[model samples]
Target: MSVDVRWLGHSTVTVDVRTPGGSLRVVTDPVLRPGLAHLRRRPATPDPAAWAGCDLALVSHLHHDHLDLPSLRRMRPTVLVTPPGSSDWVRWRLRRPATHVVEVAVGQTRELPTPCGPVQVTALPAHHAGHRTGSGFSRAPRGAEAVEHLLRVPGAFPGRDLDDLLLWAIGDTGEFAGSDAVLAAAGRAPDVALVPVGGWGHTLGPHHLDPRQAAELVARVRPGVSVPVHWGTLHPVALGATMGDRFVEPGRRFVREASRLGVAGAVQLPVGGSLSV
Candidate 1:
């Protein structure tokens, strides 16, 4: 079964997972609107409305951009999955009765039942802390660690030995030692890897992975296909003039790094584009 992946912007993507059991559509960290605070989406979203709605949403962390309440509301995924310690915050912050919210801690795997079938979701450790603190905003729950989600498809199908396709969303994270071991716990390599190669601001902290680091990780993971994300998207409104090639450079650099590393199937997908693997 082939997987269909669509890049909305930043770390947000819609993956249509099809397996023998059934088909499920999942969105990641949706920021569907035109702008997030002062950071405006560049190149413009072809159709923000197209990213709305999903069977499930995989919120990797509590960062404002990654776990936007308004965006989630717009998308209206039947279920919202976030890291541990943030579920309560999300429910309260959303200002609604979000009873379907679930928390998945690092190294924990849970099977979520969808209309089609159950899908296995695993929380993998990331090097960043998932705390949301800013002016005029409630601080996110303490001890909320950032995470990467491994979405394994077609879970727990009887007699068929399902869970064939694995889509790994390597959310915002810095390169850490022995991260491969954490990824190996998925029991199999990812079929399609979504790697973050850039950021919204001018400089990236140690908590984020740059273009080169993303390429290096992909080479190690050796996924069937790799697509660059978190770049060529949003940027601070004030720094828009100063951000010359910053939005597009990371993607080009990632492609170059992947080629240099001899990593095949590295794709540079534009915003509002889809990749099938």
Candidate 2:
């Protein structure tokens, strides 16, 4: 069996796995539209229609860029998987039926049947904080009230911290007992792991991975092939020149760090580029 991994800019990746039974395609964190708020998509905007046949769509978190409603509508995946406590928001925003949405928490697994076989998806824990955008209060509070609120509240005002899932896709598998079985089998490493190494900013935020961190993940996951996504796609519109530099530099940094960490088979793919393994 072989799988074709395509980087469609940002965290959007389409993995086409071929098995004796048939073929299945899985996409992650698709943001197809251009010029989202203060950010503008760099050159080579991905075609929304190219993702038409996606059997499964995996959303890592609820950030606007990662879980864009407009982009999700364009893909219209058969099944959408998100972290726990996010199904309600997705359903409400997408206006899709509740049945189409599936929420998987950390250490949980969801199996999807395809013509080739059953593709087992295991949700692993990620380091980043997965908070929803605009989950805070509408108006800014002043002085002592703000201090008291900050002291009392655990998280942001509205949205709670989400389960930042590092999705592991296992292809050509027959049946699994449960999440535990899947984890044990995953000890052998996945054929392809879609790891997010960077984001749309110059500096990565909390719960996100920089080049060094992503390299460490490569060593830990030990997949047959590692493709670094979520970089060089989107940047702040106001930061001229810096945006262009960020778009191409982070991938190179990840590659260098992976090599330094003695991780083999780390492939830094360009937007719309693909590699088969």
CA RMSD of all predictions: 2.6, 11.6
Looking at model 2, residue 167 earns an lDDT score of 33
lDDT of 1 by residue, 1-277 (tens): 6578888889988888666666678888888777877788777764755565478899988887788788887667888898888888788777656437898988889999886678788898888878875723576677787899898775422344544667888888998986665357767667788899989888999988898999999888888788898888888877788888887789889989999999998898888889887
**Reference-based lDDT, each prediction:** 0.81, 0.62
51 in model 2: Cα distance from truth in Å?
1.3
For candidate 2, the clash count comes to 3
TM-score, cand. 2 vs. native: 0.79
Residue-pair clashes per prediction, in order, are: 0, 3
Q: Among these predicted structures, which one has the highest TM-score?
A: 1
- Which lDDT value does model 2 have at 234? 82
